[model samples]
Target: MASRSFKELSFVSIFFSTLATSYLFFPTVFANTHVISIISPLTLVVLDIQGDGFTAMEYVYSTVLFFATSIILFYVGITNFREERLFSEKPLTSRLADFVSAGVSRDHPHLSLFLLAGFTIPFVFMAQMLTLVLFFNIPMPLSLVLLTVSAAFIEEFAKSIGLYAVARERPGFLTPRNLLLAAVAIGSGFLVGEKLLLFATLAQITESIFGSVLFLSLQVLWMPLLLHITGVLITGGFLLLWGRQGYGPGLIAACTVHSLYNLHFLMGALL
Candidate 1:
């Protein structure tokens, strides 16, 4: 066991060391500054008025926002899971954990179901960066539209991957209600994680606490929060009903709705 652990740690250390070395020397191997700015909406000319690291106030605000939203979403998901599985013989805590972890229950002290759900935040940001860097100059309006459309696919696919892994580990637990609840947990995790990461990323670029705060506030208050939940539910429902048979209709529906939701912002950006 110790030998295996040492090997794993050594591999990780080597991988990161190589990545850092490559990044330092071949920074342009990935996206350039122009492409980065385009992909990151907050780095546009408007909000990036200041140019410093995060202010103390910005840190506090972001922390509060992340935790507050996470707690609400977490509680809601767990509560819903408990209610939905009321007839099941499984204990509420185990059921809740299974739902949050997408049908698998591992015995890890440090890794909670909550943390597993939240993993999508980094996964999504990295995916977005890849797309933006590859297709940099695709026109702003079109880019936004494409982004929204593609994000639906990417996010659904990612969720499917998670579900597949967990289900493979522990089969026969994925029911319709459980799938829906799991989707909610994953989506809630994705939403909060994405928002917090975006805030920090924008803060780093613009150095403007106000801009970061405004962007986050708008997302949490108005359309984005709802849109995120709706998209995930729609996709989850489709996956629950017919995903194993086929996922075409679900993917299209979710993508279309998500794109439509993003239209307002795209138009605003253009005009």
Candidate 2:
């Protein structure tokens, strides 16, 4: 028990140290003359009085911060679960299942969905950062494939985390009617959060073809909302039909559908 405690302590110390190191070194990556602007809607509007938009460094730093925060929160979540003595003689997968099942608030489905919506923002930002980093310099067709697949995987996984957390947390929650309502709630929450973030920090990107593809901005707002709803329903349906073991397959199914949706837009942009 002592050895396990020491190992956990060491791991935490290393994680924080790495985070601090990243913070210290981050400024060195960009020019000293670069003005640091907060990525809020008001800040952007105020700073762009001269018509000069956000700098690349601003976006980079914001993305890095979001990605870092997500990682830290994920670690904290696992630690909290461990502290609750949730881990037992069960296999790793079983422990993970238990963790997911217990992570959400009991009897508070609305609150869980709301929190999940907020939780997804950082993860989606992380996904955008990763997609850009991985496919920045790659050529057209290959980059398109990679970008679509990676984005789909990340976004679907993010949505799935919320779905499973709520669906598996209690009995009768995974029923068809309940899952349908949960899917709608989760999708609506995600859509609102996603659009707000885009309006605040990513409005500029919407002007470009790549941004259009990434954000899936269409003439009608309902399309994106519908897409999100459809994606959640696909996953939720799998869970409803297959029971607890359905999450993995459901996530994969959602990812596949999302990938196809993204690919269609990407192809249209290319042509």
Model 2 clashing residue pairs (backbone): none
After superposition, the stretches of candidate 1 with alpha carbons farther than 4 Å from their true spots are: 1-103, 106-114, 167-172, 204-218
lDDT of 2 by residue, 150-173 (tens): 877877777777777656556577
TM match of model 1 to true structure: 0.53
The residue ranges of model 2 lying beyond 4 angstroms of the native Cα positions read 1-103, 206-209, 217-219
lDDT of 1 by residue, 26-129 (tens): 31332234323333323332224544343454344324333544565566466445444544455433443345444334553113333554665554544544
How many backbone clashes can be found in candidate 2?
Answer: 0
lDDT of each: 0.49, 0.63
Q: lDDT value for candidate 1?
A: 0.49
